[model samples]
Target: MGMSDKMVTVLRRQFEPTVEMLKNLIEVCPDDFWFDAKHKYWKQIFHATTSMKFWFRQQKDEEFIIPDFGKDVTEDLDKECSDYPTKEEMKNYVEEISSVARKFFDELTDDKLLEPCVLYEEITRTDVILMQIRHVQHHIGYCNNILNSNHLEAAKWL
Candidate 1:
């Protein structure tokens, strides 16, 4: 397989399903337990999706548009948060950003992978995708902790 093919395989086989797993995890959480100031379940999703979409878009240009979460990221600090979306809306957000991610994979080229990108430290385009995977999984586990402690079933990848 070529470099591009390897990149696509890794994303399709790994990152994509992990995203689906995150979606499944959110779907299974009881509505009552879905939100909490301390838990930040919804906030995590926003951050994850925003970061994924933002960084992926960054690969093309510096002018990246943040996802419309109906509120700015700064609002997350507010004690009385507003403009939060329903779980259904969040699911839709995931689907939308996931499409962007899929497109990134589809357009993957060996040269693109070698392109310079930065996420905390200097990295390549391929490493940016890897960084996104880690970031999403980190938050997924954060949500999982809440679910597991609450006696809710954690999502299993199919």
Candidate 2:
């Protein structure tokens, strides 16, 4: 195995724990809060998944099509969703993103990983992946905050 493979393996490992945490958040979210437009709780997870699709595909904004599950769903946190996705839908979408991300990583090379990211010229592809992982965790924190505020137990760190 090469360094690219190793990096991908490490990256893949990081995903499992975060995804577990995410799914737990989905499970624990109250049904009423799930569709709550005020907090946009469900939309937070929706945004995270859609973002993975965009970054993993390395597509330009114009080129990125919102997935079927997220039709007309924009990334505005303050705005309510036109198509409010369910927890099952969001879970499935997260799994889909995970599968595709593995493919993207498999196809990556050490050289390509070090190349400039398509969207951010300042950063490399590897940097984008790391940042996006952190971004996922960041949204988890947002959702967790909601849970904590409501006196609902947050998902355990897996």
Best by TM-score: 2
Off by over 4 Å in 2: 1-4, 58-63, 68-73, 118-121
The residue-by-residue lDDT of candidate 2 on 1-158, one tens digit each, is 36546766777688768767877888999999988778888877877877877877755563766665545555667665566777788788788877867777777776677888777788888887887789889999999999999999887887
What pairs collide in candidate 2? none
Model 1: weakest 10-residue lDDT segment is: 71-80
**CA lDDT, every prediction?**
0.72, 0.77
lDDT of 1 at 88: 83
lDDT of 1: 0.72
User: Tens digits of per-residue lDDT for model 1 on 10-118?
Assistant: 6668788778877886688787766665667777776788778777764444566655556533223334564466788789888888998887777776556776764
TM-score of 2: 0.82
TM-scores, each model vs. reference: 0.80, 0.82
